[model samples]
Target: SPPTPPAPSEPEPPAPPAPAEPAEQGQPFAPSPAGSAADLGDAPSQFPNAVPPTQDFDDDPQGFEQPAPSRKSGLRARPVIALALVLALLAGLVGGVVGFVFANRVFTNNGVNPSVSLGSPPPPGSSARPADSVAGIAAKVLPTVVSLDVAGPSQSDTGSGFIIRSDGYILTNNHVIEAAASQGSITVGFNDGSKATATLVGRDPAYDLAVVKVDKKDLPTLALGNSDDIVVGDSVLAVGSPLGLTGTVTTGIVSALNRPVTTGDSSTQDTSFINAIQTDAAINPGNSGGPLVNSAGAAIGINSAIATLSQGSSGSGSIGVGFAIPINQARRTAEEIIQTGKSTKPVIGVTLDIRYTGPGAKIADNAINGAAPVTSGGAADKAGIKAGDIVLSVNGRTVNTADELIVAIRSYKPGDTVTLKVQRGGSTQDIKVTLASESTTK
Candidate 1:
């Protein structure tokens, strides 16, 4: 089991008061040249004659004056005004004819305007996207994707998940809901704006997967695809609530596959080893447990961790590199958790020497802890694997580190037989082993 998170610390004491400073002086205000009447009333009595008195222009000797026209002069101007009106009417008639002729030439059937009728409006439904298009996939997948708001004793978080079963079973990353696992709350927000309280069904920390259930039934679910069918450079879309932006989708290609990714605190059971499908899709803090779907809109992986340039509690954004748990593995773990309250992890029953700096993972010559280095009658022991044997590969895949070998084995279920390329002394040979199951309960 993972260790309980530490309690939040008390806040620091307030800083001491600063030394006193002299009071600030106000700046002098300058009055406008044309001051208001209120300003004149408030002015000092000694400045009563400051403004010059108003002068009347009616008796000014320099003013230019004109007399009104006489009645006989006005009668003479009327004939001239009538002749000017008659000329203006004839000019207006000529201008109207010219304007009409110009308009008739420009607006006729031979004009550019008539040649530019809107391109026959596209056939109805022509705007619809192809079924395999990104938009089409998003349209089909968004309703199945959901946002998770988890409130715990010390902190709160938001992540993403998707409906897996019509009866309200949801699949999400274990870490997304781990904070609220003990005496907290989980709220599921749907794309349709509906929300419901959820109860934890089960979780496997080893796989970093958890299943939760709501009270509702007949909910739409996303279709699951075979992760094994995924190849490099295949177009994929990551659908999730990244940074709490619900129903967000990003596009990318499968940059790599079968990447061994180990995360979480190694000292506790919270550690997760994944045979991850690497992608360049933007996966961020809140995108955990969201689906990485193919062009067909079928989910092939679960968006999990992201590679960042910085480390520690200070968060960072995606750097074009992201990893997702293969849906094949997630499907198995999810099915097991739904059936039972827990899931199992595949183990080879041999302790690896972590300190060995070699080409391949080397088994410890002796036990590191209290347990034996090799379990008697276990899969590794039964396959004739001895202590200090370096494992070069699982099946045909090369494993350079202990984590690589562990994740490669974890990709399979219990009782599956896999061939291991092991080197003992100066010789290397192939050994077949049937993997064993260990409960992930603790």
Candidate 2:
């Protein structure tokens, strides 16, 4: 006969936590830790780009009423108790490390090291490094960062911006004015508490950059720095009006550079943009157009987006995960926009398959061939490129995807010629096409 079925054991329920004491009315929420959410009766002026503090109730431990022990029970309680102790120890260690990292990344305001305790300094500070005195730098750079408010048709949006040219040229995220460009109004607010109307000069959605101009003269401007020189662990500062909170400053290190983040809504898979710099600085909703400056108070990147679980996500704001566009790219695009009233993106007149990964941008079709438009006897029609054509390479470099193709093509100017190797069905052929300026209406 089979062994007698073991007696049914009741399921173990989670231990209840100790009840928190009700706070006295009218008391302000204290900043406990980097991630703690203190109810100050209102949302933080800045997005609480911090983590919620872990509630350890051991100090007020309530006796857990464990299930009555049975002498005849097959299993002993010692093993379960030992396991709980081990798990608790592991959790404490992990939590401590996480808190330390978060404090270092998101809570260090005005360059005061959140990690250093009891007024202890790290070491003798260098002249060029950001010491515990970020107030001075903030004062110098705050005048350069501006708050951008846009009024769109369906909705209104706000973002941060920085003055780049003394003549009143401002730089901001292109998405801030995308709707406004279609139809709306744009304005800028300065750190000195002055608001002024602004005019949209030009915008480039491909790079998510926009240029705006104000009538004022002699505006303070931020010095542009080379983002290529940045390295992980380099101290940096983020200045912006997060969540409509104007002139907020946070400090952190350059988490990473040359980071790629997909931009654009998820619905349209056909179009997207990438390439960004990752920083642990606290960046939030209204921080989009703000400046990501280096220790020397120079603009290196433009704070654009934070990686979140979803859009309009609630709870702890910045998790030390933020991205920005390189200042070099923004500066070049802004100059072109200001001079020509638009960004002249260089384009190779070929339809490309961005998903192809073998060797080059596989040509699926050519929208423009020869000279005439698809309706007008276009040059593409005369060039003999048809549907089902795969572009193997451009010039000499292999184009594994459409993004690579775009990058290569953008490097060339309009009227310049480039050679493309194509795989027509099973056969390969070389074709030369003249690059075109994106500003062309056709």
Candidate 3:
């Protein structure tokens, strides 16, 4: 069976958990584990560039639910008692010999261990050794990176993010802070072990992007690179906190691009869709919202989610198949978010037949969810889009499914006119549709 949006399974807990506030009225609430969904919202994920993607990846947010620490019994266990007995016997036999050796060596080393020696300092103008290698890039980039500790009403989640502006504007995945929106807070920790409280600047769930601001001066920021310039097999680095370990860095190459994915909690039936940049980096649950930096220490993509081993994800970490939101898409969304309280999603006024299961997205004969198949006097309708017309391509880019069409349109901004290749009545014709915001199109 084809996988739907990510909400896979609830855990068989070591013990029953305490109840918490409901996400919605009449809904029971419990914390979820990493890469799992709690709300059940679904979103379509886009691939990088114009490469057409084939499948939907229900990428779950990392560390969905962190279990409570285990409690200890009052009594000592047999294992501890047995180890203590063995240690007692060994101590009596070796204590005098150990003391004699330590006393003699402590003075013979001239008050400092002879093995310790000062090495030559790094060359001037290049404090980072091998300045062209991945280690060098990490040395420069890590200072701009941060580990986010988001506290929710019920649980706290860990994820990664990077500074985009020296004024301390940081970008991260929306899901990383979604739970914190209500009665919660986020603390940003830096590579230097210093931490600061952050406030939400803006968020757009449709794009799975969020911008948060910290009150700090002279902060280091990462340089943004053009995602369009990246190619397959390009060297990339994924830096973030995975499993609560901060400043973790992994290296890999671009595996594929323009992969269409829809990930979120299926129970909520709400999700995000996108065309993603695929890489084989060791991205684990806590790696979400981190930057995927190019060889030059520029951010090319925002590390988002990793695909699990459905009988095959390697371990609890990444399976070498991780997906990132292209920085090109993130750059646009971030600007709009910072400028406005929310970002707009581009949409063509047409209801697609998702069940058509054809080569290209097929327009439904009538509207679904009370939306008009062709919005009256709207972009598509005005551009001569008719019901039952099969859309073959958008601006010359092939769209294989309704999800693809949606993601492709979102790759652009509202008011951007794009050409569409439509097939109707056994004939193919080019049509132009100026996209409008989903908020206004209906």
lDDT leader: 1
Assess the local accuracy of residue 349 in candidate 3 as a C-alpha lDDT between 0 and 100.
78
Which candidate number would show the highest TM-score if scored against the true structure? 1
> With candidate 3 superimposed using the best TM-score fit, by how many Å does residue 327's alpha carbon deviate from the native?
0.9
Task: State residue 234's C-alpha deviation in candidate 3, in Å.
Answer: 1.1
**How do the residues 203-302 of candidate 1 rate in per-residue lDDT, one tens digit apiece?**
8889899999999999999999999998999999998998899989999999999999988888875899999999999899899989999999999999
Query: In model 1, where do residues sit more than 4 Å from their true spots?
Result: 1-127, 312-315
Colliding residue pairs in candidate 1: none
Query: Where is model 1 poorest over a 10-residue stretch in terms of lDDT?
Result: 23-32
- Model 2, 77: alpha-carbon shift in Å? 59
Go through the candidates in order and give each one's C-alpha lDDT: 0.87, 0.74, 0.82
**Tens-digit lDDT track of model 2 for 1-442:** 9999999998888778555554334333323322223322234445455443344323334522222234433345667888999999999999999998887796765777656668666898655634335776787799999998899889889999999989899999877766687778888999989999899887777667888899999999999998878889988899999999999999998998655565765463323254577999899899998999988889989998888866567775788899988787777777888888777655655565545565656555444334322222333434665665776677876766666666566545566788878787678988887666666110
**Each model's TM-score?**
0.71, 0.56, 0.69
Q: Order the candidate numbers by TM-score, best to worst.
A: 1, 3, 2
